[model samples]
Target: MSFIHLDRPDCPEAHRPEAHHPDRKLTARKLITRTGSSPPVHCGHVAMVTRVTKNMSAKAKQSNKSADKNANDRNDVASKESDAEKANPQWKLISHEQINTLLDLTVEQVQFQFEEILGLKNYQTCLKEASLLDYFVSGFWWTREMNYTCQQISFIMALLQFLLDNISEKQMPFVDNLNEFAKMISGTRQSPSPEVDSLFDAEQAMSITDYLKCSLFQNYQLYEFLFSQPREELLLGKKVRLPASLCPYVC
Candidate 1:
């Protein structure tokens, strides 16, 4: 790098002897007599010029190598950051339709089930349950006239579960409108406040919902494990496990 800097100011036309004619003549005159008809080349001066050329070439090569290395390092850092962003992102709510493919339960229908069949007290408790799978299993039938696919039923259960965990203060009555519920799940409507927003980050939300959606479409045994036994029996496990699921809501 310094050689290039020096060449810009000191050796503008390095290879051309004519470009440095003034210096060449001074060197030649010093080595050869002023009156000499035939002047021999100054061997010592020639050797010095050759050495300077070689040194400049080497310096240029080293500078280029360092520049290439820096470029590669920058590219590697950019690639790693992109991968990290994909792995974990910010979370947003989604629509119920995105998650459910079965019977379209109106918000009125869901509310009716909550108020009439399950009643207000149990409805509130059910919404606050540890596992939505358990709450749905214990509550009123979602299907009566229309044949409800198990997949649709499971999505409804999972949606309810998400609401229980993330329902904002303003959206408490949002279940009254199916359209609103759809918007809530898809993250279209701005949540009333930060408090009601999804608790999980983008990556975690994606993982949990992906599993719940898969279980909705397929037959799964883990539903029982997720929320099956009676509350008393479920709480009978070891002390370490007892505080894992319901403790957040209870405490």
Candidate 2:
């Protein structure tokens, strides 16, 4: 029989003995109601909380990313500034140590390039010509970077003159040919004059020469000391003064 038919008072009820339990029926209804209500309300609250947390987390991540990008941009700017400073060297403002280091490195590179070009036939013939130009150009650039210091311009001129003279007056025949090498090939092969070619005024040349002399003296004190000493002491004319302590090891 169908459940509706059996539940009719007129028909014999199926499981009539169990139908009288009121507490169980009430408990079962309460459990069904709670189970249905719990899932939707609890699930909705949980979903809302999860979405809020996700939004906050995503916002924090975006903020961190932006901060990282800004930091990278700042670093890039700082690096560029440093590179510019290096490329445009401030010769006048640089410290002595920095100048010395720069000079050593540049001279080494120049020497290497000169040696490499020395073997080439045309370079061997005209190497001095190119080198003469190189020296003047390097000085020009140095002066340009130094805010066109008249003193520096003069120093370079005097220094070049001294180098030319010393190289021409050196020992050996090959060194003597350097004088010919310094000749102006472009303008009728005349002997090169550091003073004449230089743009510095006469007064400026004097100042530059004085400064260059001082600098050379400071750098080559040992050379000066050695060269100035007399080979023949003339022991008979001047008696040597004995040291306070009679040790032969006395300096």
Candidate 3:
């Protein structure tokens, strides 16, 4: 007798369920059936998993965009700061005490020349007629104009000598500060030439006066501040006598 064996390896092929196709889409029903779980529970879990995956991808993209924006903002801020720093350079200013000290030193240095001018034969007449104060403030004598006498020229040259002797890199911390202060006071558009060592050399004859003229003509702001603008303390109690007209401005 030929009896059919359902549990044997030789069981009929038509009786076994078909194998799942590799390319077939996996659905909630298929998953639940494969796992031997309830359809409702597995379908809900699958939907939640899909939603969670989409949310995570969106969050990652949002985080990346936020990071990019933050980086750009920082770069922008840094660039602006750099531009601001470049636009406005840092400058140091001389103190009031330093100015006072410089004035005193200058007067002390030029005392001999001042006396020499006063000793001139026509000193009184020149002081009355010529703008002696203006000449001193200008620190230069235009021989062509012949407005100032030899005495006035000598005095201005002496003051220029004092300035050349005193204002040195060794004497002052920042020489450019003094130069910049001069520029601000003069309201001049041109800047002075860079301070030169040869101009300050003691061996150079009349180089000090030349340097002073160059500086003043290039930027008269400093000259105005030092001499034209009156300061009570500048020559107070000093034997230096200014013209009656200038006494109000200087005394």
Please identify model 3 stretches exceeding 4 Å from their true place: 1-41, 92-251
What lDDT is reached at residue 189 by model 2? 19
Steric clash pairs (candidate 1): 93-186, 93-187, 94-185, 94-186, 94-187, 95-185, 95-186
Q: Which candidate is the best by lDDT?
A: 2
Model 1, 89-154: lDDT tens per residue? 212322335224323465555544434432344433343233442344332143323233343334
What is the total number of backbone clashes in candidate 2? 0
Model 3 whole-model lDDT (C-alpha atoms): 0.44
Model 2 lDDT at residue 21: 56
TM-score of 3: 0.27
Q: Compose the digit string of candidate 2's lDDT tens values, residues 78-149.
A: 875564333222333334443343443455464444344333234334534444445544554454454544
Candidate 2 residue 63 Cα shift, in angstroms, is: 4.4
Query: Model 3 — which ten-residue stretch has the worst lDDT?
Result: 196-205
Models 1 onward score TM values of 0.26, 0.28, 0.27
Candidate 3 lDDT, 151-183, residue by residue in tens: 223333444444433332224323554564343
Global CA lDDT computed for model 1: 0.44
Q: Residue 111 lDDT in model 1?
A: 48
